[model samples]
Structures are given as C-alpha cells and as structure tokens.
Target chain A: MCTMIAERASIQGSGKTENAWISIDSCDIYYDHPDHVDSEHAITLSFSNQLDPINSRISLEITPESAKEIIRKIKAALSKGDSLER
Target chain B: MKNYKTHDYEGLIAETIQFNSANGDSINAYFAKPLHKGKFPCVVLIHHLPGWDELYKEFTRKFAHHGYIAICPDLYFREGNGSPDDVAAEVRSKGGVSDEQVIEDISGAVDYISKLDISDGKIGLFGTCSGGRHAFLLGCSTDKFDAIVECWGGNVIMDESSTNEKQPVSPSSLTANFSGSLLGIFGNEDTSPNPKQVNEHERLLKAENKDFVFHRYDGAGHGFNYYDRPIYRQEQSVDSWVKIFDFLDNKLRS
Candidate 1:
C-alpha cells in the first residue's frame, strides 16, 4: 500500500552519486514501500538535486528503529562536538 | 471456468504499442490477444503504483491465454524513464498520479480496444492497489466498462479533509453513477481499507442498489497476490483468481 506519508525539507548538502559529488538542494523523508529493502515498509531518507532527475538521488531505507538510532547518534555527536569546542 | 483447452490449438500475440492518452500524450502499452479468429472481450488492465513492471505484462498475457484481449498502459509515461521501482518511487514522492489523467488514459484505451478487429465491444477493468481505486473510479465515472475487478484498492473512501488536486473526491461518493457489475477482492488485514472501511464501501453500494460483489480473505493482507513480496498468500491468491475469472466470465462473456 502507498502510505503517501512523506515529509520534505530544503537543505544544502553535498552527496556522492555513482561517479561524482552533487549539490543536493532538497531532502525527502517518507515511510512507504522500499525499492530494494526486503521489508514491506521502511523509512527512507532521500537527498536529491532538483536540477537532476528525481531518481538521480542518494537514498537510504532502514527500519524505524534504525532511523531513531541515527537521529540519536547525530544529536550525540553534535552535543559532544559543541562541548569540545567550548 | 478454465481458460484452457485439453486438445486444441492455443497461441497468442503480445506486443508493445503507443497511443495518445489524455491531453494527446503518447503513452506505451503492452497488448496481448489470442491468435484465433474470433471476437473477444477486452480487459484494460490498470497497473499498480509499482509502475509498468514485468508482473503486469505477465497479467496481460494471462488474460490473453484465457481468450481475452488485454492491454496494460504505462500510467507513468510522463514521469520520464527509469526502472520500474525507481519510477514508482518518483511517482510516490510526487503524490501519485492524478485521478483525472488516469481516467482519460483508461478511457483512451477503451476507445482504442473498441476499434480492434477482434474486439467484442465488451470491456472490463482490472487493477490492484492504487490502480484498483482508479478502476472503480472509471467504472463509476462513465458507462464504458461492462465489468470491473478491483483488488485491494486503498483510499476508495478518502477523508474529505485529505482531498487534493490529484484526488479531489472519494470514489465511494460516486457510487450512484456506477453502471457496470463489480467484483471487489479484498483482504481483511489490509490497513488502508481495513475491514471497517470495506464494510462502509459495501454498505454504500447496497444503498445505491449497485451491482457488485465483494470477497474478503481473513489471513491475507494488502498485495496478497504479489507473489514476489513477503505478503503473498498462496491459498487466498489462488482462490481469488478463480473468483475473478468466474466473475468476469459471468459479466463480460454473457
């Protein structure tokens, strides 16, 4: 089923494709069927350059637990880095 | 009810052809027909949100083998080229195909098949998931189809608050206009059109005095017919296929 559950964010970042690094202008996070994942549903983090085609993007599909863990790790790293700087 | 013969000649021709759909967009379609010299009913297949994949081609041929001319149009032709999954992912990001465009494309297919030399002018619709929703939509929007088979179509009873440019209205709202006999195949475990929603759909049809039948499987969930997926249920899938053919035979081959 197409959950149609999605969220979009406009951000600036650089991501690697097959052969080159491209400037990504947008990111889309959606929970739906995965293209390659074995699970019926996965939370996907997709980064894309609007100039390129829609499919020409770097994407990740992981379980809900994995997504939460990534979020935790990112916050932990940021907090520790900030403390060190201070 | 079998679409085969024990001791007779059997063959079919399947190929890809392009035709103008909505707004004169030339879209590709896979068409299959029996080689025998006889008029046959046409089944315009509506591929699911998975884009135009190999499974649908297999379905087109399966119908042809059973003496029906089948055609599955590429609903995502305007979205550019890529693998089926890639294209489907892109379509999903874009909020799915618009209901109006799909209806026009399907209407065009019906028109195209009606002109075929072997056409019996009896057209039916078959679709799964989102495609199933579109099938029911078209069946109600116009009197073009003689039969409709909708398999696990989600969002048929859309929330009014969620209506958008793509899907402006719920299909259930248009049940009063339905002209064809319908066969609904659903799984009770499905989330989108859960058992309660299915009951609502059935109730709406009954109130309108529409010609429709529904079958629900207890253990099966969404996409149970998708053999490649983990949710596939062999017992339910086989039984549903038999039901589909029997329903089509009664409605279209009359």
Candidate 2:
C-alpha cells in the first residue's frame, strides 16, 4: 500500500508600514516583500526546513540615522581594505 | 645601539618652532629635548594623516630618552584638528598640500635641527603613513638625512595623480639622488601599495642599485604599527622597531 499527503502553509505580517509573506513546499521555499517596503528597514530570515520549506521570515525597520551608523562600522572594517578578511 | 626603557616626559617644555617656507607660508613644528643636554643627534619625526597628536608627543619622548633631539612638525598646520575626511575631501575638491610646501617644511626642520647647539648637524628622518611619504620626499629632496625610515608610505614610484602638488616623489627616480641608506617597512596586506606595487618598488631599487632594505610582514594590514588602532600588530611593531634602531645606529650614530 502507498499513501501521499499534500500540505499548504502561508505567513503574513505588517509592522511600521511594512509587510511580508512566506510560502513553503517539500522541495522549495519562497519569501516576498510588498513593493511599499521602506528603504530604512532590513529583512532577515531563518528556517529549519532542510529538505523542503525554509522556516521563518523576519523584518526589521531601521531609520536613516541608524543606517548611517551601520555604514560607518562597515567602512571602519573595510578600511583594512582587501588585505583583511572579516 | 643601546635600548632604553620607554619613559613618559609629557608637559616637558615642548616649544613651538615656526619658520617661513620657501613658498612664503608659515610652518609650525614642535621641538623637544632633554632639559640637561649637550650636543645630541637630531631626528625630524613627521606626523601621519591625523597630524600631530599624542602619539607624536610620545615618539618625541622616546627619541629624547635615547639622548636625541626630536622635532615633530605639523604638516597640515593651516587646518587644525581637522579630520582625515576633511583632508581627503579637500584633496579631492581643491587639491591638498603641495610637494613644494612639504619639501620646504622638511628642509626648514633640517636647517633648524642642524643649527641647534645640541645637534651635531647629523639628522635622520622618520615618518608614518603620509608622513612616511614625506620622509621619502625629504630624503630625495636633500642629502642632509644621514638615515631615513618610512612606514607604510604609498607608491614610492610617484605619479602626477598620486601627489596633490603634481610632483614626482618616486623612489626609483630618487634612488640615485639619495646619499644615505634607506629603510622601508610595510604591511603585506596594505592596500595602498598592494603586492604588485611593492614588487615594482623593489624592482626599481634593484635596477637603480640603491642602498636600501625593504621588509613586508605577512598578516599585517596598513597602519599595523599604530598601538591605539585595532590593526596594530605587536610582533611586527617590535621587530621593526629593533630593525629601525639598528639601522639608525649603523648609519647615523656610528
């Protein structure tokens, strides 16, 4: 005897004028952000679906001022130039 | 060459030495010497891109401890306490300090060091980063330097674009002009003079048959000798210091 099962799952959320969605299958996972997503925000995702669907999606909203701070730190690290690996 | 333990002589009669450059600009420098001093060998220490700071003062103290009269000149005196970004922006916008000005300022320091009663008229030049570039420039501009040590100076083979003043400060061109042996220490990972540029510099010196020693350390990035910075490498710094002292002893002291 042989049996087959099919499952469908979807995630949706909105915070500080931003929204995102995640979809998963046994073979592939997909994530999408709405066109209205703010430029000041960053998106991060983590998942534990090794064979098929990736797990979770995360969205972080960051202001322009914070972006500048992030740039400064990156510049400092990059100042070591091509010689340093970080 | 004897190694003396480092000592701090902060707030010890650090006098400002000012003079008119050949371009009719006033140059400011700091002169530090032992309170009890006979004639001493003088050293002209040049500041890096950050200009004269506490590190320079500490260097003066180190030189003074070894019975050497030390002078550290503010290469960018016109703009005080300005950030490196400011200097870089100015250079990109209106061009920075001229090579003529650098030569004049350094020559003036050499003259001042030579004229000092505590000096034997035998002087050496030491610089880091941009100041290191100036040390090479000063050495090429004048033979007054008995010895020269440059740390992580960029592009010894000068180009019109490399120098703001459109002056050629290449080591290959200046090799024959140099009357004293030179020491150049750089980090292998330094992006300024990537491996290719360093190899070219070595080739130039070899072709010119110049008397020079070059050392490039692995795993060290640009400005690795700077203790306050995260890139500081203790092993390379200590080893380079020892080599510098040896070079100075053989070429300047003896």
Candidate 3:
C-alpha cells in the first residue's frame, strides 16, 4: 500500500540542492512505496530547504526493519551519551 | 468505430507535452497514439505513488501500439517535475495530493484528450497502486470517463481511521455514484486492498447493481503487475494486461 504516514519537523542544517548550498528548513520521514529500493514498502526520509523549493534536499529509502533498527541505535547512542555525561 | 482487432503492430508517436491541469496549473504529460487515420478511443493512464516515470511511458506506448490514444498526465506537475524520487518524497511529506485535485486533474486529462483529432471522445482510465484508488475515486466523482481499471489500489476501503485528508472519503461508500463500469484486478495476498476489501467493495457494487468485474489471483501480491518491481508476477500481470484491453474495448469500443 502507498502509506503517506509521515512526520515533519523543522530543523537547522544545510544541504545542497541542485547546484548551490542552502539552509535546510525541515525534515520528513515516512513509510511508503520505494522508487529504486527492491522492497514493496520502505521508510523514506527527506530533508529540504522549503524556501528553495527546487534545490537543497536529500532523501533516503530503507526497509521498515532497517528503519526500526536505526531508531533503536539512535536511541542507544543518545542514552550512552547521557550516561557518559552524567 | 474502426476495427483494430488485427491491425499490424506499426509504431506510434510518443512525446511529452505540457498542458493545464486543475486550477489552470500547467503540467507535463506523456501522449501516445497510433498513426492510423481515424478516430480512436482514449485510455487515460494514471501513475502510481512512484510518480510519473518511464514505466508509465512504456505503458502509454503499449496502449498506443495496441490501438488506443493514451495519455498519462504527470500528477506531480504541481510540485514541479523533477526526479521521480524527489517529487515523490515531497508529495509524501505534503500528505499527498487531495482527492478533489486528483479528480480535477483527471478532468484536465479528459479535456486534453477530447480535443484531439484522433480521439473518439470515449475514455477509460487505468491506474495502479495509489493511482488505482484515484481511478476508483474518479469513477464515483466524475462522469467524463466511461470505464475504470483499478489495479490493487490501497486504502480504497478505509474508514474514519482516516490516515489523512488525501483519502477523506472511502470510495466503497460511493459505489452507487460510479458513472460507468469498473474492472478491479487484485492479488489475494495483498494487504492494502486485501482480498476481503475487494470482496466487500464488490458486495457494495453488486448491491447497487453496478457493472463490475474483479479478478483476484492467488499467488500474486500488491503491485504484481508492475514489471519493474520485485513483486511483479509475470503470469498474473500478463493476464491482467489482457483484461485491461478487453475491458477498454468493451467499454469504449462497444
């Protein structure tokens, strides 16, 4: 199925569009049909500078399991950093 | 109507053209048609969530070679045509195009195809995946089309669990509003528009005395007809393609 279930958030960063560099305004992550990925459904993420509209964006398409694993790893890393700081 | 039952498979002209869609928004479209002299029925092809790409162009030409005027309007035209993946991601983030916008876009397609010298003014629509849902939606939303081929459209049977406004209304509830016949091709294993949903939709259509044909293959799953996808089931896809032709011929040519 084409799942448009996505979460969007404002972010501070910079990404290249087509040619020039621009400040990224937001990030979106969702699970939907994959374009080049072999899987029927993949979790995809896109970072874009909405102001640019035509440039400065990046995207990734990965499997749901992989997405879950990445989330777990990110949480683990954050917890490890907190423990180290304490 | 000119008989294309046994026409030699000569080539047809295929090209990209820009036209205005809903709200007077100019969008890119792929148009294909046979070179034979006489008016021909039209098949308005709708692209899936993958966004308009080369595969749909291939489908358009395939229809043209088989003797129909086919045009696939890039639904992503509003987002600005770029790489399919990029446009798809943007669209996904934006919660996808609205149902009303889609209906109007199809109307734009009808407008474009209706004026062509080769067009017979009869048009049937075929859409895969999300496009399939749009196809079914248009059948209930508009009267410009004579037939609709919905291939494994997910979420056509959704309720108020309403993922988003993009699919605010369940097409199944509007079964009686269909202006013409519908042909649905599905895979038994597909969970989106699962077998039960297909049966339920059929039940509604039948109760309404609507013209409908549904084919559910056992071994296939969602997107079984997509040649470029991993789930492509050659046998089932071939059969469904033949069914598409038959449905179009019956609805538009008959």
True contacts kept of each: 0.32, 0.00, 0.49
Give lDDT per model, in order.
Answer: 0.88, 0.63, 0.84
Q: How is the predicted docking of candidate 1 categorized under the CAPRI scheme? A: acceptable
DockQ of each: 0.47, 0.02, 0.49
- Per-residue error at A11 for model 2, in Å? 42
- Estimate the Cα RMSD of every predicted model relative to the unseen true structure: 1.9, 17.5, 2.9
Local accuracy of candidate 2 as per-residue lDDT tens digits, B1-254: 46544584333346777866556677777778866645778888987754466677788777776667888877777653344323322222223456677788778777777887878777888988767777877777787888898887765666655443345456546756766778988889776656677787778777877788999999886666777655678999888888887887777777
Model 2 has an lDDT value of 0.63
Ranking by TM-score, best first?
Answer: 1, 3, 2
- Name the DockQ score for candidate 1: 0.47
iRMS (Å) per candidate: 2.1, 25.4, 2.0
lDDT of 1: 0.88
lDDT of 1 by residue, B1-254 (tens): 66556888899999999987856888999999999998999999999887899989999998998889999999998888877866776777799999999998998888889899899989989999899899999988999899999998888999989789999999999989988999999999888678898999999999999999999999988888888777789999999999999999898899
| DockQ, candidate no. 2 | 0.02
Give candidate 1 misplaced runs (Cα > 4 Å). A18-20, A35-38, B3-7
Candidates 1 and 3 compared by DockQ, better number = 3
lDDT tens digits, residue span B1-254, model 3 = 22345565576899999877867877889999998888999999989987888888999998898789999998987786567767877777777888888887888888999899888889899999889999998999888889899999888888878745666788878888888889999999887888888889889889999888999998998888778877888999888888888888889887
